[model samples]
Each structure stands twice: as C-alpha cells, then as structure tokens.
Target: MSDDPKQVLRYPQVQAEELADWRFFLMRLHARFRTGSFVRGLELVTRIAEAAEAADHHPDVVLTYPHVDVDLHSHDVQGVTSRDVALARRISEIAAELGVEAAPREVSTLELALDVPDAAEVQPFWRAVLAYEDHGEWPEVTDPGGRNNTLWFQEAPGATGEAQQRFHLDIVVPREVAEERVDAAVAAGGTLVTDEHAPAFWILADAHGNKVCVCTADGREASGE
Candidate 1:
C-alpha cells in the first residue's frame, strides 16, 4: 500500500483490460546523478520531464533528497499498457544518455525448508528422483537450474508431528516434455501423488516422502494472463 495518490492512479488493476489492447508496458527508472549537488537533482527532473513531453507520455516523477522514482503507465488506457512499455523503454534510453543508472528489475525464487525426521534419507531420495548431482556439505538438491533453484533438507531432531506435508513443490516443464520427465521420476522411485486433475501443475512425491509437482509452462501462463 502506498500513500502516494500518483502511485495509486498509475497502478489500478481494473485497468488491466485496457492493458490487454495496449502494445507497451510500464517501467521505473531511477538513479543518483551526481554525488553531491542538489542542482544535479533538479537537472535530472528537468531532463526527464523534457523527454516525457517530447514523447507525448508523461511519467509520475517523485523526487526525494537523493533519489528519484518514476512511474510510467498509460493514462489513456488507465493502466500499464504496451504504449506504457514503449514510453518506459524510451525513458530508460534517455536516462542512460543523461548518465542516469536505471534500477534493476526484481525476480523471485521459492524457498522451502521442511522438517524431515531423517535428513539423510530425504536428501538421497530427492537427489536420485530429480537426477541432481551431489553438491556435498550441508546436502542440497537442485534441478537443472542449479543453485538458482535449490532444495535443502535439514534434520529436525525429535520432531514428531505427523507428515501432513502442508507445503509442496510445483515442478514445471514444457507440456511436450511432461510425460518423459514424469516417467523418469517414476522410474527413479518417486511416487505419483496425484494425476487427479490439476488444470496446469502436476503433483508428485519423492522416494523419501516429500511432495512436488511437474507442470506445464502454460499452467503458469493461465494463472498470470
């Protein structure tokens, strides 16, 4: 939640329908122009405003003492549309020409830490099931994505809760590749938890007893789009 009215105006989700017809997207560009001068801040604002005006797309610019936050969304569409993306890309190019360093986009990864009574048993089961190589020390399992997507199992000493498996993994693969991967996992001793009916994501479990899913990319696309 942001108190900024401009931010609210720029990100209304109801406008997503308007976005579908649009050909661009929104982007936020930020930078600390010069280390010491307040005048440099003013100059940066002026430059951004001029660029926006020339492009006929104005961005909501927020200037703090040392940082600037630019929110770019298409007003005509009432949300982020393809036009907004075009403007954002141009704004970034302009900022770069003016020596402003754009902020990096953020990405997310899932982290699951479960309490397995036997860490050794669970670790081996997962390694063999996913065809993951031993990374050694601390004992971790990963997909081909390597360290980027990893699963670490730690021993939970004296823990006696039933293995309800409240949390599980959603493994995704291309639709064409699904059967092959699923077959491989089954052959490697992993169990098929459910072939019941997941619209997109498939659910599975490893030999030592942790649940995971094999899904199609379309599964994620459906949820997002």
Candidate 2:
C-alpha cells in the first residue's frame, strides 16, 4: 500500500469492503472487537501492536475485560490514509484469527459542545479545568490521553432565557447507524430537534430541551450543506 502523508482519504474512498469492520469518524478509523476475555483481549492487542509496528503506524487501543477498542489514523496527515486502511484490514484479520467478532455499530466517539458567546474567553478556562490540550489553534480541547470526550466551543447568541442550555454532546457515529440511533433516542422520549441536516447530523433534544447532535462524517466532506 502506498503511504502518502499529504493524501487524505474521504469518507467515500475509505468505505471499502476490506474495511467493513471499521468505521470512519473524526478523521480516524474506529472498531470494537469482542474479545470475550481479558487474556484473549491482551493477546489480540499484542498482535495488533506487532502489526502496527511492522507497518510503522500505530493506533490508539483500549483494552477491557470483554472488548478492545481500536482507533487508527495517520497523525502526520491528520486523517485516514492508505496506511490506516491497510493496518485496519490487518487488525481485522488478526481478530478473525482469534475468533473475535467486530462490533462496528457500537463504535462511536463523543465530543462536548459548549454554547458560548465568547469562545476565546471561556476556552482557556475549560482547557485548564479539564487539563485538555488544544487542537492546533482551533477552539477545541481534547484529552491528551484520548480517554475523555473532546470539548469544543460553538458561538451562539448571549440570550438569556428560562430554558437556556449551555452545553450539549456531539455523538459521532457511523453513517449507517445514525438513523437507528436517532430512532432509538426518539422512542426513549427524546424528541427530534431537526433532521434538516440528515446523514450529516441530527439535532435531538430531551424532554427538558437539552440538545445533542448525532453526527456522521457523511455529507460533511465536499458535499454542500
């Protein structure tokens, strides 16, 4: 596989059969494998580490008693590349060898969005409080260890109201699962805030009016708003 640091694969380009086990989100390929045991999960992790080392590309891995979550992205390119795809394929093969099944639909990433009138004034405070690192010069802070949800600022009017909402979550998931997630949420008493941006994002609110965005990478790259 060709490794070009400047070449970034779009969502459509990475949606190949070879990468069926992985889902693209927020510039990374995410997959969850059901290992069924801690020892089995560790063995899978070791093999994945070896594969990553051999390919000269590493992925963020989280191991637990019943599963292992893997996130792959080319740090230099700041997005998914052929290298990530190749490694993801290899990781899937390793899981298959160990009889571990992938839970692709269960892979998701969370981000916190804070509604603020002045992003610069409040960004620093949240960064300090959460001890999160800034992503370049963007108005966002992320956990350095990739353990916590990323926090970003969204500019909004400074209007005071009885039902003022200051914060909400951005649940990023695979495009295929976005609708199902929305349906489930709605069935559970959540109301549809808006689907005007369907396939890209859906704004949903709880019974009390707290809002969240169920987002996907689809319709976000090159596609018009």
Candidate 3:
C-alpha cells in the first residue's frame, strides 16, 4: 500500500493506460463487465470480495444476469485515491481471469439537481421525502442503499422563477464519452447551451429549452471552480 492511502488523486494522476477499463466520473472510478451469465457474474463478484477483503478496501458491486458493475472510491477522503486505483486494478485483473470483458463506455452515473433560491431551506424537505441520507459537505442527498440517483441542491438564489427549469440531470460519464453524448444530442435536436465548463460539465438543452449537464472529473481539481 502507498504511504498516503488517504491522499486524493486528481483525474490526471490516475488516468494511466492500465486503468483503461475504468472511467473517472464524479470523483469515483466506475467500470462495467459483461459476464454473459448470472453464474459467471457471481463468480467474479466472489473473487472481487476476496480481493477486497485481503486489501481491506471494498467497492460497491452489483451483479445482473449479463453484467457486473463496480464503483470504487475512498469514502473517508471523499474522492478517489491510490487505494482505489490499486483496488480497481485488482478487480480488473479478476475480471480478466474470469474472461469477463469490460465495457468502459457503458459506465455512467446519473444525478438529479434542483435549482432553488434557498438550498438550505429546501434541502431538508427533499431529504426527508426521498428518505435519502446527507453526503459530504454539499447539500446533497443519496439513497442509503445506493440504488437511486443522488440528488444535489444548487443554490441559484434569484434564478428560481417560473421561467427557469427547477430540476435537471447531471449525467456523469467518461470525458470522451461525454463529448460523444453531446454530439449525439445535438444531432437529435438538442442545443449546446455552453461549454464554459467543458470536461467538468457541458450544459445542453432539449428542443423545448429544458436543460441537463454532461459531466466528467477532468480538470475539476485543478480549476477548483
């Protein structure tokens, strides 16, 4: 293990070719593997559990009939770190041993965002209604079981009028995948609202002007914006 397992690694620091199977999105590492059958997926999951137990670091795993999804992050540091990178490598190796191929491009996470004049005032209501738990220092709520999409409150102050869309989605995907999605959306009649936050996020609007953001972890730590 590294001397500083808790040291958070920036997106650039962890983007080596060995991690091609994984994607950095929203401060975590995500990967998906096609297992072809539920039995094979369960076998991979069992190996992952053994590896995680040995390393004393665990990842979130989900098994389905044809795929196994894994999400890795150092929860204590609230970000990806050397620990996650090492564990991700181990899991990838385990998947390879099981003849499971990775589908990196298919790994993505969705989050809901609510624009409000007073995030502090509105956050409690949503948290309670959704039965979600508070996470990090942000006014965000997440499913306690990690099944549903996370909900984050964006304080837009005076921007919450009837003219503005109060809710939108933040789709976190790989940097290259995000660009591809943006292109596809534009081809399908969606408009690019702004790339002012490119790589970190791109604001896009539908034909009716409803908005969503395609996001990645690139340059987020450097810009700190």
Candidate 4:
C-alpha cells in the first residue's frame, strides 16, 4: 500500500487477492458481475447505492441486461485510493449476498497513450522503466505481464513550443456499443473532441479538462472508416 492514503497505486502495487475478484485498471477498480437476471441486477444496484450512501463513496455503475459493471475510484484525487479499496470490499459482499459471480479480471483490456513531442525519445524511457518488451512493429512498449496497460507514444503536433496534455486514458470497449458509450458521455456534460475516425475512436473531455479516448477493436482498419 502507498504511504499516503490518497496516493494512486501503480499496477504492480495493487495486489491480486486484495480486490475480492475486482480488477484494477489505470486509476479505477472495475468488476463486472453476472446477476443472471435483469431484476437481480437492479436489486444489486439498489443495495450498492444504499451501501455507498452509508459510506459516502459512490461507484460508477453500468447495467446491461444480466450484467452489472461497477467501477470505483476517487475522482477528486484522480486515482484509486484506500476509499476505493474499502468500497470494493463492500461491493463484493453485496454481490455475494445477491449470488452474483464476477467476470475474470482479464476480460478487460487497458492501454495508456502518451502525447509527446517525440515518440522515439519518450518510448525508450518508458520501456526501460517498465522493463517491457519492445513491440517495434507498433512502436509501443508491451508489458510482459499483460497486467498493466500497454504504453503507446504519439507525436503531439507543435508540442515542442507549447503546453498540452501529455498523459490521458484510452478505454477499449466493444465496437457495437461504442456509439452508445460516446453518446452517454456527451450527455453527461463531456464534450466530444472528434469523431473524424468514427467507429474507431472518439475523443472526449470532461468539464475539468481531463481527456479520454473511447476506442473500438478494428473499425479503424475495416474500409478505412
């Protein structure tokens, strides 16, 4: 655990057995529960909401038919903290009471993108820092463990002489639901950054200026769409 309670934990720092079947990706703790029925899922959410209210820590939830996806994080601190850990434990107990099972941790994939003035120079340092394999084919560093997010460096046009966000999140979701996710985010006060590469990836920014990219599997390769 980090010395500071509010400190964001790195991938390796988060222990596997500590999360009670939850997965840690970037700054959030994620768990997808199979409730077996839509009504059961709703019940689970209600219980979770009550628990969150009692604890004063809420999680972002998404319900899709028989599955409920719960994501816990401390947005103010910009990362997962002890608060998330505690809430995850409570969530697991609630899931158990509802007889819901969690999906495997590896079901979710996370990738980190860096906007830098030069990819060549920045890539080497990150590769060394993570002791990762050089996937020269895509020019990105790959984590051998596959537990941490893959690091990709992109060139930021005119970045050398100006200030720009260097780090951001890239969330990979199913292609069929990309549009729905993008629309939901826009409806939640997030501005759409660009859709020029529709069905491939859409960039969106929160009111606080933090940027995130919603990406799909191969919409970018098929028919150059």
Per-residue lDDT of 1-225 in model 2, one digit per residue for the tens?
A: 345655888888787545779998899999999999999999999999999999888999999999999999988867888888888989999999999999999999987776666666556544543446788778898988888888887777663232687666677778787787787777655678799987888987654455778889988887753
User: Which order, best to worst by TM-score?
Assistant: 3, 2, 4, 1
Question: Which model, 2 or 4, shows the larger TM-score?
Answer: 2
Q: Pairing residues by index, what is the TM-score of model 4?
A: 0.51
Q: Could you tell me which 10 consecutive residues in candidate 2 have the lowest summed lDDT? A: 122-131
TM-score for every candidate vs. truth?
A: 0.43, 0.69, 0.70, 0.51
For model 2, name the residue pairs that clash.
none
Candidate 3 local Cα displacement, residue 120, angstroms = 0.9
What's model 1's overall lDDT? 0.56
Top-TM-score structure, candidate number: 3
- Number of backbone clashes in candidate 2: 0
Per-residue lDDT for 40 in model 4? 91
Clashing residue pairs in candidate 1, if any? 23-82, 24-81, 24-82, 24-83, 25-85, 171-213
lDDT of each: 0.56, 0.80, 0.81, 0.73
Segments in model 4 whose C-alpha atoms lie over 4 Å from true places: 1-5, 109-153, 156-225
Candidate 4 at residue 153, lDDT? 69
Residue ranges of candidate 3 with Cα displaced over 4 Å = 161-225
Error of 1 at 9 (Å): 49
